[model samples]
Target: MKRRDAYLKLTRHNGRAGTHGTYNPKHNDRSFNLANSEHIDPERAKGNIYWDCFYGFRSALAPQDPDDLAATFSEVERQFYESRYSNFVESQNERNAKIRHTERNRSIPDLLSSRKTCPEETIYQLGTLDEHASGEVLLAVVTEFIEEFKARFGDHVHVLDWALHLDESTPHIHERHVFDCENKHGEVAPQQEKALEALGFELPDPGKPLSRRNNRKITFDTACRKMLFEIAKRHGLELEEEAEYGNREYLEKQDFILAKQKEQLAAQQNKLDELTLKVNDMETLIDEVSAAAYDKAVEVVTDVVRTETRKEDMRMIEDTKKWVLSPERKAPQSTREYTAKHLDSVLGQVPQDHADHRCPLAGEAPEAGSPAERQGADQGKSTGFCSATAEPLAGRADPTKAICAAYRRKIRKLFSIIVRGDVY
Candidate 1:
């Protein structure tokens, strides 16, 4: 019979013939004859000859189908051992029942009370060592896997938790998956599964017990190192040989660089604050200067107006003196003196009529005429004097012109208060 057919027939018969002993009957006799013919030493006789015959028997019964015999053996062993081990089976059953009860009673509202909900499912829990790898690369691979996983599965899956445990013997991630029972919208589950598939992880069977799954007990130290390297390769984020060492020197250098950058940023911020304060101070100073300049300009203009008014009044008095003392009004000295005294008395009593009275600069004398004639002569002279001097004083281009021009120049200077530009 062919070796493969013989093994298959033996398996189908439920026979125990080949489980312990060799299937081949002639192998022992053949080895004994070879040892006798070679005159082998006794110690060698007990070792080499026995081992060769044992291996020969094993080879004859070994399956040649190229299937995973180790996996098949493990399954068969589990089934056989579980059937025979009643105590172990009962313990496992009790554990599974408790887990199922917990899952059924747990509500999403209860979970949300203590934990924040994330949009995506199948969160990639990474170790601190894993985070030592490039974050950009890790996130890229993880995101791609999440997308692919969602495409394959529905959107009922959600990541309930993702945490990196760094303060342990082996840095690892703790991840929790929550199946959305109320996933009518189907937005979260499908995309999450798709992303997981892209990351090359086997899809987890929801019906399986949580304790039986490989993901439940995953630790950063015991995780698939090869898979992490593959993810790095996909994203082109592999670290250099020196970086992979993770030595103290490298860590110190990184710290120094980061500290320097922080210091530089702080300095720049401080400089900006100082500049802002300076600008505010300058603005306040400008306002003060502007107020002072405005007040000074007003005072100067008021003084100019008063001085001009006084000079105009003096010129009018001088014109009146010229008109009243003219040769046309010549009179006796004694009569002029008496007329001057009466005019002064009237001018003092009625200050408002001083403008029309005889000028103070006129000689203290009355003209040679009757009382009515003197009065008519004084009235005629006053009108002529006013007409002549009014035109000269009021129409003169230079009248108080210098004072006004100076005031305008001072006003322009005051208005030139410098104001700073605005900060961005």
Candidate 2:
């Protein structure tokens, strides 16, 4: 549920300084009259003026009884001036360098830096009574309300000037004060904590660390509302209290947002850590995947080579069978003649116009006049893969034996690499 709005408003202004720079009673007086619409005072113009004092029952927030208001203002104003606090205030200001100590004191040095004597003053409306009512109704209610407040409040707080202002947008009492800022034993109290307890009101818990700081302001604002509420009850007024203290709600919401932001930051950090761990293992993961792929590649290449080798071996065997099964073996000729016949068979399979597409093999190339080159073959010319022997099987009728041996040697060399797991 939404909280009801506040009807009473207590405000403060330090009387130490005026709009120009320093404290000036004339400046305060002008402001007071302007606020209360007393510059063209209606009652004073009629010559049937009700009172001759700064304040009276007639000068209340809503003066219903002129006699009573005049009397109250007279009594309070008389007591205020009789306090004889001006000498103390003037001397104190001089000592603090706020003003010159004497008319002819040019040679004297200041004891302290200039400062206004009173630092703060306070004021507020009694309740919402001014909103719904005017004149005597407001005056009567406010008078009773102030009486209750004074009876319950501290004595160290001295009222200097007071007036009920009906000329404002809403009626409120303007009160000036000099907080007797020292404790009972004559030592200064921080933020007037001990001084405010002059009536034996409950002392604030010292355990609250901020009692001297922010809580000091909050505590007083709370106390003002409490006092008004209690008094408004006796007057049958319907003032309500707002739930929020000035700026308190905004500050609390900011704290909550800040806490959530911190949590999100922590969560993001955790996610980053997990990602970092994964990145650290990336090299190992890569090696594992690479090893599996290499094994599969070796298996595929070996199977393909073996299948081609089998077909080549069968053809070579068929060619050699013609030579070994022939009756010409019983009348074998010289090795050179047999080699020449063997070369013819192999050359027949090669295109006659493609002689320049030379077959190259391993080892040094034969010299121009050597037997290998003479038969249209060379060595040490790269074929992109491992070199094979291409030694003049041309013009040799027994080419089958040499071709078969070459095939076996190449197959064996490839198989050994794959079997030993060294292909990669």
The C-alpha RMSD in Å for every predicted model, in order, reads 28.2, 18.1
What TM-score does candidate 2 reach?
Answer: 0.36
> Candidate 1 on 54-90: residue-level lDDT in tens?
1111121243244533222223223322333334334
> What are the TM-scores, per candidate, against the unseen true structure?
0.22, 0.36
Cα lDDT tens digits for candidate 2, 1-424: 1125444433323334446553433322323344445343544322211222245323232443545432443244334433434334444456557455455232101111123223243445443433344434445654564566555553555554544555444444445444445534443322344555554444345565554343444565567657656655666655544443334553453466687789999999999999998987997899899778756654554444433444333233223333333444453445434443543444344345433333221122223332322212211222111123222222324333344447566644543332243111
Off by over 4 Å in 2: 1-120, 126-132, 181-191, 201-205, 208-220, 244-424
Per-model CA lDDT versus the true structure: 0.36, 0.42
Collision count for each candidate, in order: 24, 20
The top-ranked prediction according to TM-score is 2
The regions of model 1 sitting more than 4 angstroms off are 1-190, 193-265, 284-292, 308-424
Error of 2 at 372 (Å): 60
